[model samples]
Target: MGVTRERAIERLAGRHPGRRGFGGSADPAEAAAFRHAMRGDHDLNPGVTPPSTALTPAAVLVPLIDHRDGMSVLLTQRTAHLTAHAGQISFPGGRVEDADPDDVAAALRETEEEVGLPRDRVSVIGRLDTYITGTGFEIAPIVGIVDPPVPISIDPFEVAEAFEVPLSFILDRRNHQRIEREVGAHNRAYFVLPYEGRNIWGATAGILVNLAEVLAD
Candidate 1:
């Protein structure tokens, strides 16, 4: 039988053993390996400071849904006209506002504003580590579970399309490709997952890669 919404929430809420709940199940050996690998990366280091002068705090909602076959993650493709990361696959989010009290609030508010997902329908499980992007924003990733069969209306000005990718396909290391390029004076390394003519890269890819590493563990 497939995992029900209650079962998934129970797992995330620490009702299950050795499982840091998000949306997927993790084997003991895989979790250990992922932790070991994450420690070596500077970006994953919690102490590293972000380079951007704009102290704009941002929150992103990483929506995980339970499909009959398996789990899938909801992502959005930004319209080409956007000023920032245009034409990139990303989680629905934006800068924190004075009206928003916390990361979860900001994420929910942004999701409603950007994608027309009602705030009340989402059940927030917990949060992952905070990731600092090179682009001048400290991003907090809020993981949440949405009851399936909910309707989504996309805002064309901000989101070109909203789609889901099987979480299992992303968790596999084989699909995660590392690329090297020179950014200014330094050689930078990043990840890219090219799917359906869309190039998933940069900070967006980094966030997914981190989440994948966490779940794979």
Candidate 2:
């Protein structure tokens, strides 16, 4: 069974188990304003700039809730053949094309092309903050609500598998685990959510952390 609209909304509204410092506690108005500023404007975070000089524009489609289990977020694992971030868990998206009018359109178009998810079936709610990846792509994360019972076809060349994680599980503050690792010559700290068999970390996890903060507020 697919998730219903009411159930999805309820899940988003419910308290998240993984609530951490990353998920700021603020009033709805303040939180909404922060989210809006982050999404609308690019320079919200002036201190943390892109590490690389390359600037490829990309858009990620964050599908929230497919009907059967109320509200679940869809994610994908990229095929190892990819040049960048191969074998990493990520949202369905890619570099924007000249044919796409804007970021949102590009995201929807890419989702359809990569995952066989029809654009018409997705209702975009809003966008999250843009993230500058270490690999040089400036990614705009667009959150959308997908109706249940929709069929999906995965492109074997780009996507290894497609799966859904309950939004509630993602939203809960307790599930967000913080850890440190050595990257190159420096130590790096990040969040990780080990869902099913997939280890969602790095840029993908950072995006989810931002989303969790917004939803918690």
Cα lDDT computed for each candidate against the true fold:
0.70, 0.71
User: Under the 3 Å rule for N, CA and C atoms, how many clashes does model 2 have?
Assistant: 15
Task: Give one digit per residue, the lDDT tens place, for model 1 in 31-148.
Answer: 3333333212235334433441333578899888776667778889999999988888989999988898877899999998888889888889866565556654656778788767
**Which regions of candidate 1 deviate over 4 angstroms?**
1-49, 52-54
List ranges where model 2 is wrong by over 4 Å: 1-49, 52-54, 66-69
lDDT score, residue 214, model 1?
59
Q: How displaced is residue 71 in candidate 2, in Å?
A: 0.1
lDDT of 1: 0.70
Which candidate gets the maximum lDDT versus the true structure? 2
Instruction: Provide TM-scores for the models.
Output: 0.78, 0.77
lDDT of 2 by residue, 127-209 (tens): 76676665656677877888777579999999999998887777777888887776677666667898887789877887887
Choose the strongest candidate by TM-score: 1
- lDDT: worst 10-residue window of model 2: 16-25
